[model samples]
Target: MAKNGKKMETQRSVDQEVKAICDIMRRGNCAGAMQYVPELTWILFLRILDEMEEQERQAAEAVGAAFAPSIEAPYRWSDWAAPGSEFRTELFEKGQGNVFAFVNGPAYGEDNKTSLLPYLKNLEKRPNATAKQKVISEVISGVDRVRIDTERNFLDVLDKVDAITSAAIDDTHVFTLSQVYEGLLLKMGEKGNDGGQFFTPREVIRAIVRVIDPSVGETIYDPGCGTGGFLAQAFEYMTGPKNEKIKSADDLSVLKRDTFWGREKDNVVYPIALANLILHGIDKPNLWHGNTLTDQVGYGGLFEGAPPQFDVILSNPPFGGKEGKDAQSKFDYKTGATQVLFLQHVIANLKKKGRCGIVLDEGLLFRTNEDAFVKTKRKLLDDCNVWCIVSLPGGVFTSAGAGVKTNLVFFTKGERTKRIWYYDLTDIKVLKKTPLVSKHFDEFFKLLPKKEESELSWFVDLDERRKKAAAEASPFKKEAERHARAAAQWNEKLKELKKAKPKKAPAIEKAEAKQKAEAKAARLAAGKAKEIEDAVYDLKAVNPNRKPEVDTRTPEDLLDLIEAKGREIAKVLFALRQ
Candidate 1:
């Protein structure tokens, strides 16, 4: 009861903070909360960083280890943003009537000289500056967007931001500020900020994470991690109470600093991702602020001196975006399409036996029109075991304003795929209305490890797929050839008949023409009938012992047989497991 009460109180606090910030954001020439949320995020990040650093200092003292503050005294959150603070008073009330100039402008400080932004930037020169301090400096230097009109208004908003934390009040409900921050990020994505490309649905992220099952020490990465959703979800999955995989504080430390990594190219979106990670408790996130498709040698920050290979990858690279010849030159399968290039990159960068769960556009699934597209699919099958594909329902991404059909493709490198299990999720009603939830994937999760087949899920063996493709292609070519040969014979015979026609009766000529036409029609009908007979034989032959009579089945009858076979296989699998 007490815990429930605390949770309810925290819920109230979260709602209050969001409403307050949004209301304050709309007050002046200031735009909507979407533009201003980043500003609030930056401020909240500093405050959280200071508090986290304090906690670390205490922990170090307890263990008798040497520790120091990341951000030095004067520029720290307590010194600058805390109410009744000295720096706050000096900047706002002391000396001149240049409050806005003091912050937004370049002017005087403690000894009557330094500006706020300039002083923050000067922190970089401090010897032995920690990684946390470096991130703080980087964020502050890029904060030219916080355009509050008055000092009072700024202070009021700052106060509201500060109060969002449980530590700011006398409540025992210690809520994580990351939750509220993520909520704001969700809202921003819903508004189609940055074209809604930077956000993946949380349910989709969770479902992918559950299947991937990232471990504690595994180096998990997202090549195009938008808002760091996959990495964040992976962290939570590994650290959950049921997951005792993380055995030590050292493991926890590694998970915090090194495990989760990503790259974001958009300038507007990079800061949100960075701030998002910081708010999620990563002091030093290994996120590169550049395109993931950039050449590994040219971009050394994330890749280091050599190519980067990871144990697991979760990504939803941008679809329909073009990378021209220059970008295509870096990849083996050169295509202007962004998703195709990302697919090649993911395949190349994954370590042998590394697993990947990627969301790709529908075009990548069946597009064999281009050499690059065919080669990409061929390479995927040749080098990876594409075990499952979950076809996501349309409008799953509509909240983000994307209407393209998407699929979650799961595969592992260094193995040839003999068969691919496909799960058709397009028919689920909840996905169209209530949207996807983890429960929607409950049955999929159960059947996935077993490769169990259901009404919505079926297997397509590579050998069978290849055979089907060849058969489909051969019939068209062969039929066209047969028609051409028959026409040639008819024309040759007609010339001979024309020469002899003067001597023969017109009635006899007409009867011969009718007979020839009927014969040609009969040949075409027989050819089609033979094709249907062959398909039936193949279907029945799947069960080798059953030599059923030659009975031609309709399309519906064929579908029923396939479903029955799937169920029988599923039962056998379950029985064997038992």
Candidate 2:
């Protein structure tokens, strides 16, 4: 498919070309990557979409089938942005007699033809508009007008973007245009950017996808698809060289048009995610643009058709995200922690025997102080076989501006977690340049199967630990119940006393309140007893088999070292004074 039988490659990697585009935006009003990327996302999306529609039209024509595009004649990329494009040539006449006038259009003239933005924004209202049309409407729903601030600068951006195409990619590399877009996303998530929450490191996405190993037939979903990374990676894994299961058109069809689904509430992120997956070659991204945990709606048209449950789920929900009471009202275990609520949502949305690999905050793994956190972890263990937990190195998310210690939990529905195999990578320090790479997880992938134990890995028999805790708590629960029964008896006695002698009622009521307080105390004791097991659920991969790093020196030696360091500092001060 290379033009002229010479493989066309971009001037550089896709990232470089995207940078070139952003650089042009920078010359105009778009000052930062955050500002330019969103404006660029829709532009790039429309460009790819037009090419894809052109291909569809060609295919339809080849077979002599009736052909209709999602975006018709004058609005298509070739019709508006290409050199010598008819509508573009007439922009002075069509766009209210000025090119910039069409940016936020009232392109209605004597001819009554709509300009680009108005046409795109009006697609959904057309009679029996397709899903793609509705999606097109929402992707640009947030863009009131062009942000680039001038006609010449915006045209330059289009010219640079127009060069990116399937035909322009190097044939030698197993490539997708999505790789280029990913680089733009990385810039958006770089150390200082405001888009950190939406970005997960690329290596993290790849590792989770490799472990989950989603296949062609299975439906993959991400409840919080930040830029659709999980869904995009899963698509790559299923269709990549490793996966040979895709033998027929139907299999690829299922993967492309029917398999991927997700939900995101942020308006900026929601559209970006849809574009990301589409670039990854997923035809129908099936993404819902709304809060996953709440009833509030943004645009649910694409998501409304997603199956209630999916066969595979992969995601890293936003860490330390906060939700209000309205978001918490839907789940049984109420919590303001976004990660905790997303965990419940993930568990609730998995199909029987379904598999999931999710990134969770390390604090969520270990903290037993929050009742919601503990209950959710317990519910996870009760409902799924959490076969593996990988303790990620510190700064795994530093590149994304998240310095939080994190963990990867792999689980399957339809079974309970008996034991959890843990692989520790905490000792590997990650810096901005030197990040958590695939080689860091080489040992992990090697030891993951058979649940092997090493200095870096170990397993915990959760079933045994819980059994021990339950046995210890059994007597406590029984004693608590006895106290509760006695409290009830006191309540009845107080009632009887009140009926017999009204004057005695206050004193009896005081005694009854004391009994009830004891009962409450006893119940708390029983919960604390059971909580011992839940505390262990803080499954940090602190490998017990590994030798401890002990301070070898005794007190005299330690004191000598401290004095020596103090003397050295004083010596430096003395030299300075002299």
Candidate 3:
């Protein structure tokens, strides 16, 4: 009984270690673990399966039924744990093939020839088998020391993994490792420049999440989901335990399985996003790989393709600056390629009365180019509730070397936009000398306007702005009036000064002129005396008796000495003048 307890305790410790390893991945270190992915995933899957199988076997024994562990004995946890025992050798030491084959499924046989045993045998004989086994064993032992099942829940384990992985990554750590694994795609868009267009800052994601407040059961979508940051945040907001009171179990499940959807143009990041969603525990998300601007994914009457529309849409569309050779040709708003098309896609994807939080460059707010596009955007604003526009500070993407100022525009479809709330945070300090060490978001969040009124934000009526614009026909009238008043004042002053002009020279002028002449004569006499004294004290000219060593000295040396003496005399004269 004591030995059994010790074994169980050891197993519990291993689970904790596994949790810690995964937690490290969650912090953004998965990229470092990329080399170990195949091994780590395989080992972890095996361990989990082993645990599940053990529970099944114990239950079967208790019920008086004959039972056998599905996994072969050689690959069992106990056999693998024997100190210094190389499981790889037993599985594939000679010409034997993959080990995972037999251990993965059933035994190799003529009737069941497709068993995993052959593959496992082959895998053990691979050239790097020893190294692979070592890595696998080390990871297993490391995780084995942690009692994950007893000390932490599954979600907590996932979070720890996410933290670990994210911590390992550099700038791309915003989306947790699970998010990356579950379903967040990152692609190098057009010459790598357009990537920033869809790169959403974490603070921006939080702000959008706060404003949209995505509830359970409501579908959320990002038509231009770059790395799935926005969608992942929405997922967390809806399913996180903090929201349990407000969200029902059924609603949360719906959110996990059916509510989240996204579309991406690049194929590379598609897997990333899918993995991100999966890591977040969303099974089979409705994400698609296509140009949302041109393609349809039929969600409700929102688009031609689907019936269930999204209740919330959050996106940081690529900034419409310039496009490369591989850019999409069918886009009508190709002049402002990225952002304009994404705006249209967002509008098309949103369900009636749906809310949207989008980040756009400030130019979109007042660009005269592309009149039709501008008109469409403005009309959408007018038809909807353009709730707020939070202007973000520059230098948010300083690491990318692009400092384009951006703004978050929140709107709700089918609602009247009588007043638009504007929060001007353009002058806020968002970045420091080191891009990663700044604390701009803290103060910004504090000053953010709640549902209540605040000094940092105010609502401006559209009608009042129109009135102000119309009343400013003669823009320079006030300046012209002020200039005319200043000219009149100058004329009046000139007339008064002319009448007050006066006076003549007196006898003091003659005395002053005589004093000046006497002072000049005295200065001349003193200068002559100083000249005579300098001549008398001139050592180079007076020391004729000290002449020697002329035969040993070169002409150049004599000239240099003469030059040095002349410079010294000049220096004395210059100092006296000062």
Candidate with best lDDT: 2
Model 2 C-alpha lDDT per residue in residues 1-578, reported as the tens digit of each score:
23244444543555566677888999889888789888999998998999899888899999999977899876788877775677677874444336666556757446766767888988988889987898788788888888987787888787778887777777356456787788889888987988888999989999999998888788899888989898998888888754475788899998988899988888888889988988888888898888888957788778766787889999999889889999899999999999999999999999999999999988888888888999998889999999988888889888888888899999999898998898888889899889888898898889877878899888899978887877877777777777778777777777776678446767877977877787687778767666665675676667787778999899999999999999999999999999
* Per-residue C-alpha lDDT of model 3 across residues 105-212, encoded as one tens digit per residue: 455323455343233334424465542232222223222222223212322333333223222333232333353332212222212344444456566687788778
Question: What lDDT does each candidate get?
Answer: 0.71, 0.83, 0.52
Error of 3 at 171 (Å): 23
Q: Candidate 1, 578: how far from true, in Å?
A: 72
Please identify model 3 stretches exceeding 4 Å from their true place.
Answer: 1-198, 241-243, 296-308, 321-334, 400-402, 432-455, 468-578
Point out the higher-scoring one by TM-score: 2 or 3: 2
Supply every candidate's count of residue pairs whose N, Cα or C atoms clash at under 3 angstroms.
2, 1, 81
Residue range 1-578, candidate 1, lDDT tens digits? 12123332556656666777667766743565457666766777777777788888999999999997876666677776777788777766764445555555456545565656666655646686556655666556567634666667777776766566535433346345676777777776663554368888889998988888888778888888877888877887887733376788888888878787787776656667777888776656777766678643312233232237899999989998889787798889899999989999899879899999999888777665566777787788889998888888778887776777889999999998878787777766543348777787888888888888776677777767567755765765566556656656666766666678465567447646755774576567555644432332121002222235686999999999999999999999999999
Runs of candidate 2 exceeding 4 Å displacement: 1-14, 84-97, 108-112, 171-175, 241-245, 481-524, 550-578
